[model samples]
Target: YNKYFSLGISVADEMFGLLFFVLMAHTAYGDVSYSFLEEMKRGSVIGNIAKDLVLDVNRLSSRKARIDTEGNRKRYCDINLNTGELTVAERIDREEICEKKSSCVINQELVLENPLGLHRVIFNIEDINDNSPQFKQSVIKFEIRESALKGSRYLLDEAHDADISMNAVQSYMLQENEHFLLRVLTRTNGRTYGELVLNKELDREQQKEVTLILTAVDGGTPPRSGTVAIHVTVLDANDNAPLILPSCLIPGCVHIGYNITITATDEGSPPLSSTKNIHLTVADVNDNPPVFQEQSYRAHVQENNKPGSSICSVSATDPDWRQNGTVV
Candidate 1:
């Protein structure tokens, strides 16, 4: 009787062990999405890092789990095996990789053990306006002719921004100036360039040099900007004629011992003024009246002197030329 009872107990224990094995729970693989800033430091925790992978490790003591990137392309991130924590392995720069594209996606896979599973992670690297607009040169220089017509256009070297999307360079601004305007152009590579267009004419005589400031701005929340100083020099042109200045002396009339001076001014590159000195040599026209040496001439005459005899000689002179001064 004792042998038969022990056999029945062993059979019951075996049957129950088989039933528990048939009812064992099976774990399923998990999938999830996560977001992180572009430049997260290494060793930082990324919570909810596929927490469903192992479910409850405390309750499922038999479950073992781990996460790793696909192959050797773990350029941006690393994952914790025991804690299911994700961390940055290397700094990620969206602009450097995206190149102004609309989206940046980093495709990776994390593997889990115990209840074997495979999971895919899609990391969307977002952009931030961390870069300021930059110019190739700090100072721009140009030499233009003063007579250049209005509506002339001058192409300039383009500016660059290290960020993409709205953080990239959008437009340009020129300082308030009466002589020029600003224009923007886009290239096939999505690079925006700038130009200086002449709206008003220039005059070298009036203004020799012009200093302007060009600013490039981006379309960020707090827009970033950069500036370049533009220096333009206007060249001289011979557009004016010389001018004669009136002298104090009158023309076409002269007298002895008189002087005359002539002057002229030029509007050349280096303006100049010239003067000429002249001495007048008078020519007589018999305009002077004859006069005696004394204010009143006293002629001594003997009473009843001979009628044909000249009592005293009277003298007179004329200022006309030899032929015209002949007196009768």
Candidate 2:
């Protein structure tokens, strides 16, 4: 049966171009597998299915040889009757089809009529380095006390890649610096993550903040990577005691009856302080004398004024409120 089919196909190929076919199938003709890179262009030739399955190319037109994806709504591939070649009907993006699966394979069936036959065809969609590792956030922040111990580990946001296997994120790199370093860890589930380790103690007064870059990289050739900025804020810790100076000068206006409070604080994380209150009361001193309204006092009386006769009155003024400025 195979020999006769091949002979007919050869003659048809020499005459009219092999064109068009229908499918009839109940008999299984075994499975055929082909490997292809992901993201193949539409209309790209995959393989000659008729040749692989030892089918009659001539019978394709009369018997109707076609492809079926088990009632799939989107057909990814098609069979060309003229050349018996299987080709991509639409673009095949492995990431869209299989997501994070370790391996991606598309199953299809090649069917033909006449005697009726079914051949299983498998397409192994290999991964390509088309995706870069990505973090959920652009920046990560941390707060540590100035007294924080060295070798402290801070978990970081894990990077994700759409592509799997060698194309997925495999390692991490932290920008070189004295205060921190990067540590890559693998989970029991075969997944990887990153940690930031503190290599030195922080001093809030000397250096209050630090920034570093963390990068996630894949193992693909000409690797791709994503980065996130790490910001660390060093909090203060109580480390110094309050000190009192021998003497201090008071500022601003002060009166004899005024009260004042003095506070002293230390430059510590949580500062220490002391306070003192003062009150004052003293006797007043006379500083001004009374003044007459006219520099020289002049009074006039009638030519033969009698004793105790009334004369022009003399007046004096005092500026002080108390007896210190009184005129007698």
- In order, candidate lDDTs are 0.71, 0.80
Off by more than 4 A, model 1: 1-32, 43-47, 52-67, 80-83, 185-191, 245-328
**In model 2, which regions exceed 4 Å deviation?**
1-26, 243-328
lDDT (10s digit) by residue, model 1, range 85-175: 6777778887776776777877665544465445666678888888999998998999988878899999987778888878889999999
lDDT of 2 by residue, 1-328 (tens): 2322465476686432222131212444467999998778989998998898787787788778888775464677899888899898998888998998888888887766676667777899999999999999989999988888999999999999998877889999999998998889998877799888889988888998999999999999989999999999999887545554535444333465677677888776467787777564444456557888988867766798889987877778786546866788
- For candidate 1, the lDDT comes to 0.71
TM-score for each of the candidates: 0.62, 0.67
| lDDT over C-alpha atoms for residue 303 of model 1 | 87
RMSD of each: 13.7, 12.9
Q: Which ten residues in a row have the lowest lDDT in candidate 2?
A: 16-25
